[model samples]
Target: MTATTTPLLGQMMDVPLLVSSLIAHAARHHGNAQIVSRRIEGDVHRYTYRECEVRSKQLAQALIALGVEPGERIGTLAWNGYRHLEAYFGVTGFGAVCHTINPRLFPEQIAWIVNHADDRYILFDITFAALVDALAPQCPQVRGWIALCDESHRPAMRTPVLCYETLLAAQNGEFDWPLLDERSASNLCYTSGTTGNPKGALYTHRSAVLHAYGASLPDAMGLSARDAMLPVVPMFHVNAWGLPHAGPLNGTKLVLPGKDLDGKSLYELMEAEGVTCSAGVPTVWLGLLAYMREAGVKFSTLKRTVIGGSACPPAMLRTYEDDYGVQVIHAWGMTEMSPLGTLAKLNWEQAQRPPEAQRALLEKQGRVIFGVDMKIVGDDGRELPWDGVAFGDLYVRGPWIIDRYFRQESGTPLVDGWFPTGDVATIDPDGFLHITDRSKDVIKSGGEWISSIELENIAVAHPAIAEAACIACAHPRWTERPLIVAVKKPGAQVTREELLAFFEGKVVKWWLPDDAVFVDELPHTATGKLQKLKLREQFRHHVLPSALEVGDKCPLEPLDSDKGAASGATANTKSAATRG
Candidate 1:
């Protein structure tokens, strides 16, 4: 009566899901769908899916002619444009790994990544031509360089470089894509490496294809052939959040903004191209919003935008949805998760809630997508409840999620078969994830835990504050307390006490930040997330007024009832997780 180990199989033809097939399907079904790009040449270029397919085939043939073997790593330092799109399909179509390098990283870091990835050839845009020349000496393993421009437009470089158009012209666009295993690696992306050296995430054809499907669901990005999609996210970042594959899979018109990602350029392109939906980080959207406010203009065709890479401030979300009539899709994920975990799309029941209630729910990171499974575990490694009160470390597992980092000889970083996301969060009964803070960023004072994200969100809600970041600082009596570092809007001024007073009723008194400081701007990672490590180091020796009063000569332990000092350890043990 036990379940059988083997079962009868159905009569169905099996085919491997590969990256090449997505572009082929688009070319065959929706041949005329346009792919628009504002090229670095200070002009816009347009092409169709059929043309893109032919050129992509040409690129594959060219790379192969240059002796690029399957499974080899090929790098790209380009923007989101037609040529970059061609590389996405071309390099992967022939079974080569497409490693997109972020040009914004330090030259040394870029060289280190290139050397670490063992990239055979780097296809770079003209904007990065000087960068390639500067780092070419450091990347000794790189075999060749190709400028992503025609023979006439190629820049003079210290190293020998090939012209992209000349290479394509030699090919007849008749190469056939090889039918490879679906598990073959198609893409490579490295973490920002803020703490140390960068680690890579190798994505397979099966994972990429499945992620495209999962990301295009109605509750996800809700992509379709009718929508004009503009991904403000770079091609180097998590495959632009999987838009390159998903866009062609659905035959959606892609509007690439190239190197001109400033507010004016992006707004003009979106309006000119009649963009319907977009996706990017919060910082990009903030610039666009600022431009719109200054110009007194609104989106004519833009509808919704997916904001990820970091938490979207409540104030920014409200402005996008209320003032501009655009739906803000708040999303959260890590590069290791194929970067798509949870997206805030309300269901019918949740939508029926009052405006205030619904807005509060939207602030959470939303429910997990179909491909992902999530849970919160306390310091003891026990799963926490979904009562929305208890917070713990977040863990996730899925087919698309990485089991091990590329080239990593160390043992797997998973815990009991789950990948720890290093985030402290709480989940509601309906399965919404409310991230409290990163495990390393949370502040512990008087035996109580404080969420820096919550504090920053409240700080940014003040009109005078343009951006804010809360970091844990040393305290004599409390061990560590929250301190706010903020940037004021242009021509806007507010005193430290006024900023501190703004958070009075938003959060509990115990959770309020000890002090607020103003700065010209804040440090950010290449991917647009706050660099708290640098902030913590800068303010490590900053003395608080309260600490000065107490005198740091000798530390004194507070009574049990003084400020819940005795319960801090127990509270952390039960609800918070300590990340290794």
Candidate 2:
């Protein structure tokens, strides 16, 4: 029974083949399990596993008839809905790559990604009609466009277009999904490119299947059929953390919050569908928490949630667990690594601790799952220890992880056999991973490093702050200094002096933000991480001199000098000393 004695390289399974097998299993054993979709037309659509399989087969056949080649890129600019789910399987199930375009990205960025990926067909939701119409003329390689909406919602277009439902209706459900090489490319995702132009990460069938398997394990996400799953995370980002596949594989009921992702709408859907589990970013949860607090709405059926795409603040995690009786699992990943690298669920021993202690442990990214090997290396290319005190750059290697960049083998950032994560973190004795900073985001001032993420986290913990970002700006004395930019909560008034005082007891006095700038809102990347580079550029010229520098530069003046008397400081004392 050993794999060494087995034949045919473990059956040469591909992602499409695995998906087809899972669909058949669901149809046979879980045929009545539900897939619910909230439509933009103010209607609710529902389907079962049996119906989904039949329609998915029809979609696959339709793609084949429309001249979709095995490796051609087919893009989708849709939301989380059943029709979008159909494209998820149909495109890749036919051995073509599904390129998910983020609708939130700038139009120019969208056009760049589409043209760079050479996407030949695009299936979009009707909500993006204006965006698609504007970009369609520039996408030369795209040959066909399909709207995921039905006849009633489908908008008229001048370009060559087809209706998604019409195409599915025209095709027969008798076609067989072709056998494909397991290593063949199956999906393409571009990085958010906050610092530079986005690069495509083409995932192979082998990588996707393995990643789906890893995501379903107990130590990883522990998803099961008993859990009613709702993926509020958009389909355009990292395959909604790969739950679209893991859910069906586990026979879980799926609730798709289509165009209406507002707090009231999501809470209502979860209650109606009896949803037990959901996944989204911290921003979405913040809105939901505010809505619930304001309306006194409750989710009796919701049991757990997974927060990702950015760090989950300890306050947000505590609110969900303590107030709503829900467990918030924090996860971290990028567009690469099939977008699932780390999760914040406690192990058995940690779960046995007190609630407050458990929350502290869960704040850090959890241990790496099986099939993933991780290490932190210093600037000297030396591997750091797992003591949790010493921070270094993180690196990972696994069966499902990417080994090279698509179409640019020489430009990839693979180190030895591992992929450089571009993140700075420390691993604790308990094997938990904590991200202190991104490699580029860490600030080196006076030869000491400062974690902007840590600063931003502390700043946002203030009650009056809605969001905060920290960046390094050029300083004449320290070489670089930390600048804090913050957005205030609605109807909250927090002056710079008061806000700076809030950080007094929490962090080192020197670590406090040199100067605080208030804005209505902070700019966020397409993937939800705060855009610090923009903040740095906006405040590069502002700087505060240190006490030593001020003392050295200014000599004592006469006590009777009018300049010192008017400035609120005695003539004998400099401004730096008085402020300190």
Candidate 3:
């Protein structure tokens, strides 16, 4: 028997075709929709969808005039601003892959990424001018640099730089968008690479457009024209969780937070723009929450917040939902998954339940979105039950999911068409996923694994703590133990005993932090996940007492100035005795 060809379910959409055509569609359909940008200069920039389209077309023409080749990469080191958004569509709309380089990464990492992506032209925001200058010497592949600034904020650099407006001025407003293959690469983002060197995930035009569509669904992000969206997540990260495209497609009001992500600035922008929806990692929300409590500021107009790039603590969910009236939507994904695999939007059945019940359900990352499939596998490579109790490595596959890493690296970890997301998770009977920890982050003590994320979340719930990270520390008896590194809230003092008490009854006694160390700040990855590796390195030499070594007195004590002085003299005396 002959195999029959399958019929396509949706319309074909290439990068230029989808982004440019959507611009035209939004201009024709939702021309009155607004785009608000808060600049670093403390000025608010405003434009309508129609005006944005006009500018985007002008930018596309300008990019063409700058000699941007059809498939060449155009990099942008920008914040979440109108100019960055313009570059997003303008570059991809003209068939060039928009490589958004994360400025937060180390200068060397940034240079490596630019060189790896082979970006021909770099469009940088004013705030990253110094960063660009630092990385310019290392990135030989970057042939041209354009500063995304107007006349007032022209970047000052020793190298000959092209002004964004000047380039636009040189070209006509009209340019033809090439009709390219749907599977052609469009956008590129690198993983935070907590485990290894950052790897690029090249997204195809087809994948990006599909991701935008999936992300806009009511069951996904539930975005619409009626909503005003402020993407607190940087544009350099996972296409800002695909909000830039989904916002325009849904005709939602776009609010760009620019370079100011501090609590006061973000709160003011959200309030002024009447932002109904926003998206960011938990760290950003933590700052916003602290600001609200300290300043008595409230988000009266905000309704929903998409929190991801790290686990959203239950306290954050409750504070936002019950106290502030903003629904905290937990989302989960990696750079390889088009950065959006699941969203925590409650279904109609769950939404009708009590708020407490709904919040409990929302705490777990919600069901897989349409076109996405998820499963869990145990150590023996057997599929685990979705009973919520069985924990295993989570694997996912979807239309928009990446099949392989860019540049064809060996050991790409794609198995049977599914990408093994390094995250260890449990899927409940209701199909919600709860991430326990990353495969490498889970601490195995005495042969039993412990979830570092669970410990960290519980520790941070302590009122005096601002943030927390738990890492596996070397143990003489147990073979491995947990060390909690925490940053205390400003003006708040917390002792190790106080924090350990907070974990009482919340987790297993064995899982309690063996030692709690206070730091000014917890190290975070570019995507905002806790950098436990750094924490481990910081406290690796901490000596713990064994059963025989333990006496009545505790081995650990606060380091006092007097003790240091005594020890300093002892060291000198010992040196003199050795010389004699």
Report the C-alpha lDDT of model 3 over 1-580, residue by residue, as the tens digit.
8776996688765244355666667778999999999875668999988887778878888877778878889999888888888887788887888899888888988888888889999998877788878888888778888988777778788656788988877766766666777778889998887665798898988788788889999878889999999999999999999998888888889999998899999998888889999999999999999999999978889999899999998877888988999988899988998889888877778889997888777888888998799999999989999998899999999878888787876666688878999899999888999999988778888888888888888887788878878877666567667777778889987677778778888887888777676767777887787886655544544544332253423323212312332242322212211110
- Note the clash tally of each candidate: 1, 0, 0
lDDT of 3: 0.81
**Alpha-carbon deviation at 369 in model 1, angstroms:** 0.7
Highest-scoring model, TM-score: 1
Where model 3 places Cα greater than 4 Å from the true spot, the runs are 1-17, 351-356, 409-411, 545-580
lDDT of 1 by residue, 436-487 (tens): 9998788889988899999999998999989999988778778888888888
Report the lDDT tens digits of candidate 2 across residue range 1-580.
4457555656653344444556667767889998899976678999998788888889889888998888899999999988888877788877889889899999998999899999989999888888899889989889988998677677977666788889998987876766777778888888887755788888877777778788889877788878889998988998898888888888889999997878998999999999999999988898899899999988889998989888888777887888999988888887778888888877788889997888777988887777788999999989999998889999998877777766787776888877999999999988888898988778777788887877888888889888888877555566566767788888888887788788788877667777677776777887677776555444443444542354434322211212322344322212211221
C-alpha displacement of 417 in model 3, angstroms? 1.2
lDDT (C-alpha) at residue 467 in model 2? 85
Model 2 RMSD vs true structure: 7.4
Of candidate 1, the 10-residue stretch with the lowest lDDT total is 571-580
Residue 554, candidate 1: C-alpha displacement in angstroms: 10
Provide the lowest-lDDT 10-residue window in model 2: 571-580
Better of 1 and 2 by TM-score: 1
Backbone collision tally, model 3? 0
